[model samples]
Target: MTSRLVEHLGPSNISGASAVEIADRIRALILDGRLTVGERLPSERALAIELRRSRSTTTRVYDILNQDGYVSRVHGGGTRVALPHSGTTTVDGDDESMIDLSIASMDSTPGLYDATVRSLPRLAALRGTSGYSLQGLPELRDAVAQRFSARGVPTTPEQIIITSGALNALNLVLATVGRRGERALVEQPTFPHARESLHRHGYRMLPTPVDVDGWDERHVTDTLLHGRPHVAYLIPDFHNPTAATLPDSARARIATTARNVGTHVIVDETTAELDIDRGWAPRPFSAFSPEVITLGSMSKIAWGGLRLGWIRAERGLVGRLLATRPSFELGTALLEQCIAIELLQDMPALTAHVATRLRDGRAAVAAGLARLDGVEMPSTPGGLSTWLDLGEPISTALSLAARDRGLVLPPGPRFATGGVLERRVRIPITLSPERTTQAMERLSMAWSDVHAGDEPRTLALPHAAVI
Candidate 1:
């Protein structure tokens, strides 16, 4: 599993060229698998010595590599290669294993489409066309409500209003609760798309911090009780990026606080179902505050292509959301609704399959990342991306380095909760076992470089944040 990266630009010949040229050489090495996963690269000092170049020139070279996504930087440590991904191919035709730590959610089952057609008769037989109902199709409402009830919170069809996806559900909640200029509180490093929706619709932001260590209970309690945000978006179940779930007690406390401040707490349970090891069955924060609007989706459980999500709310606000549906998404596809119902009926089988695959994938990535030195990851099993503490400040450079190798990964700021994590990255487990292993090995190389103080070695980025 351990290998040296010597694809091109032999160390002795790595001098008197531009930083871009040096970066290209390093990138080729990674792509060609000269740099294996988790291998600690030579220090900046050692590399400069090897290449017989000034330390500054060596620094610029690493900076270019960092920007291009071939390596990661750690403050006071050195740099290491980044985890590889699907399209990482070298000029020599050698390919680096790719780890997809970019997007959340795994691909869903294939039979889902056929399942929808089978359920159409009951809807079509309504003696006429099932015209648009602000409230979703009666059948889907029952199915969605039943899903919540089955999960523990008892509810009826009247409580469910199906929408386009979790994004739609959040929009409805924000529009009903927030007005422009009033602050809408959200967890820091939340789903970016949701954040964009909130911003585009004219709501100001008040970010509450949360991470893999768990919800920043005190900060969240303060934000809800004192900040007076019109609405507080809560992802108490398996948070994205950080993958931190609110413990049951904290969930209740935060809900109580939201009620005290009159902020409608909007709970997004998108990734709560994608846990690989422990059951991701965290109870909704709404259990403590039924006044809270809880958003659920089949996107992660099934496929993202299925654009169906639902909101469970108190009847009054639910009606407002229903009225606004035509302005945005008319409704969850009538046919998709039918298909979802069929999928729901056979949910146990799909659930078992998902749980099994996720378990294997999580183990594979977690084990691979653990092999790298100076990298800290939470040992507790949950969520899609592994929250990694890289022990240096060149996360941005690392991402750049990764890109040069044709392995695009999310930068540290992509997951910042009010701007604290920098020497970190989210190594997602969505890739196959072999790919994840390869990615981790590259990561080790990047970290080795970071520890050696050669990360972010480019002059163009001296004025820029290296993330």
Candidate 2:
């Protein structure tokens, strides 16, 4: 745990800072979601050594944190992050109102309500029998397999396993393939919860850099050949945050390298179908090699509340997942599967609706952010968000200030495996055009406040469950 704490703390250059500065930096980490609740802080002596400060300074900082309800120390239990007095908003009062940009889900598709209505008869027919299916509903699994086949990846119903959502599918994959202390290759500034899940499962992450421009294929191939990680997780098509798609040439290199090194690749295609303006669509990563496992979800295309996601792997791996799934969950809900079956049948219509929504959203967010100086938002052909470079390393401070002004922005560090990417932040283009304009106005004001030295109002952040 001490070593993990040191790794998470990562290279803090607070060599000669005052106790207050140290406390503020630590507090910023906690608020930014990098240092989660109940995580133990390093021992005062060790932290003092790392920060090159006196033991008294470290002790004083701990005392200050304890006084402010940011941490609690037991005689032998060590110090842990704690909830603040004002409770979960992280700002004094005003807990009830704020625009949450942390969640990247889009609204339900136009036909979702109709689909739910249409699924009632099929659901009623299954009410007499047992609803528990460890693998998933046969019809839905077949439909999902057919969807994959349509996308140019040959698949069968036997190779598909349904799960609650993409995160659950990811967890199951990690649990099945990952061993304790093994290396897992991930894109730098990738999805935050995926990194959290890897950490929870005891995998040491080796990051490969990915940016708005696109993947550095050479770096990825080199890492795969040398790092020899047990698994490589990638969001190749319409990637999250950055919305950069990996070119086919890069995909072939990654696939060939992984196959040579015996690294299993897990491709997340949750954002693949959200194409708004990309002229060409690449085939599934698994199309290059049968060893690759692919994950897809209806959350992005249809609705997140439906809680439908599926994993496409070899039949043997699917059987293994089915056998081990009971320990975690009984099965996906029967109604969600039925609804998914209905939704999959008319994907053309649903996809068209999604494309229109995301196109307008992309234009609105890009245009709004363009009005602000020093904000660099790259235009993406697909995906739900933009990775914005703020031209400064004030992401955590900006997030804190935004909270005070009634907007919730996830800091850049929230997306990183380590304590880096402080100059970048992800802004979702999933809001209405009007709301996007309003949020940008508020964000501009918050930036100004932060730049002018206005501190975040001290409050307790909500407790996030450990992954």
Give lDDT tens digits, candidate 1, residues 10-69. 443444667666675565445433344456777777776666777887788788767666
Cα lDDT listed for each candidate:
0.67, 0.82
For candidate 1, give the lDDT of residue 265: 78
Residue 379 miss distance in model 2 (angstroms): 1.3
TM for every model, in the order presented, reads: 0.73, 0.93
Q: Note each model's CA RMSD in angstroms.
A: 11.5, 2.4
Candidate 2, residues 58-77, lDDT tens digits: the string is 99999988987889999999
Among all candidates shown, the one with the greatest TM-score: 2
Q: Tell me which residue pairs clash in candidate 2.
A: none
TM-score, model 1 to reference: 0.73
